[model samples]
Target: MIEKALQVFPKSYVYRNEELILEPRNNVYFRLVDVETEIDFKCKMFAWVSRPIAKSLNKYWAPRVLKSFNTLMDTNFTKSDMYLIYDRLGNDVNRKLTIRFIESGYDMELLKR
Candidate 1:
């Protein structure tokens, strides 16, 4: 999964050290550490789990994940530029989640775009 994510975001720039951390709880957290300033910004992800499916599974197995990426800009980059990148990453994550669920033999209807 990490390798696939890296493939989605293959380029590295000089601004920051970004890493994606996924927990067993199905929570995806992104930490962006600024290289020069030594500051870290966090982005949390929320996944949509249907109530019926949640009850059936007896756990919070996220079917559709919605990522709201945010970071305070103290750097040279514009807010619009940051948001563009954030949205792209979010879209990539969404695609990955969909593919993973499909491969696991779960009904795709549990996930909605």
Candidate 2:
């Protein structure tokens, strides 16, 4: 799964970084990529990664690190709930829904341009 997600981008750019810059792109699909095909492979990779991570509940879990999300309500939640919340936000595995959901607790409608 990890290997698949990494494959979405160029292999030369893979590495551990001490710092990162995260941009909040509300509409991650059409807005970020000029063509929808770019995300088709990514969506599959996301789905693959989400499955196993969704099952793990140990402290410092993979989902927490990968998603880096904080809920609006400060309540204990499971990884399954996280996946469900994201699924409710967007029907697919694009990270846009998760980003928007993390930004606004309410379900945000994705605009099609």
Candidate 3:
């Protein structure tokens, strides 16, 4: 599973801290929080697509695509501050979507916190 996940999420890394670790990405560290509930898990994902891709999608496909997918799962999406965010409960499909979004001449910005 780790190998498969790496294929989709090469930017993600695993590190250990003194119980709590700060993720280095600027948008990520402030944007995501892990929560565990009795029956649900919550996580967040972000995609930094190209400027043109982001602008084009902002005009049409983006909102519809997000809303359509949101209807199928416990997911909420937002595009703001030059990033697209998917906050969901259970499942990691957001990572797959992030990869697909990045495939179209888009790249993730690895920012220092």
Q: List CA RMSD, all candidates.
A: 15.5, 11.6, 14.1
Better candidate by lDDT, 1 or 3: 3
> Can you write out model 2's per-residue Cα lDDT over 1-113, one digit (the tens) per residue?
22333333222122233111121121111122221453443343233333433443344444443453222133344565546643543345456654454445334333211
Provide the global lDDT of candidate 2 against the true structure: 0.36
Question: Per-residue lDDT tens digits of candidate 1, residues 1-113?
Answer: 23333333224122334645432234344544421221111112212122112222233332222111211111232333333333432324454554454344433334433
When summed lDDT is taken over every stretch of 10 residues in candidate 1, the lowest stretch is 65-74
Residue range 1-113, candidate 3, lDDT tens digits? 22222233324343442111112231121122342331111123233222222353545545543443333223443444234332211134455544444343333232212
Model 2 misplaced regions, further than 4 Å = 1-36, 63-65, 68-81, 85-113
Residue 65, model 1: Cα distance from true site in angstroms: 15
User: RMSD (Cα, Å) of candidate 3?
Assistant: 14.1
TM-score for model 1? 0.18
Candidate 1 C-alpha RMSD relative to the actual structure: 15.5
TM-score for candidate 2, residues paired by index: 0.29
What C-alpha lDDT, on a 0 to 100 scale, does residue 47 get in candidate 2? 36
Best by TM-score: 2
- In model 2, what is the error at residue 13, expressed in angstroms? 11
lDDT ranking from best to worst? 2, 3, 1
lDDT of each: 0.30, 0.36, 0.31
Off by over 4 Å in 1: 12-18, 21-113
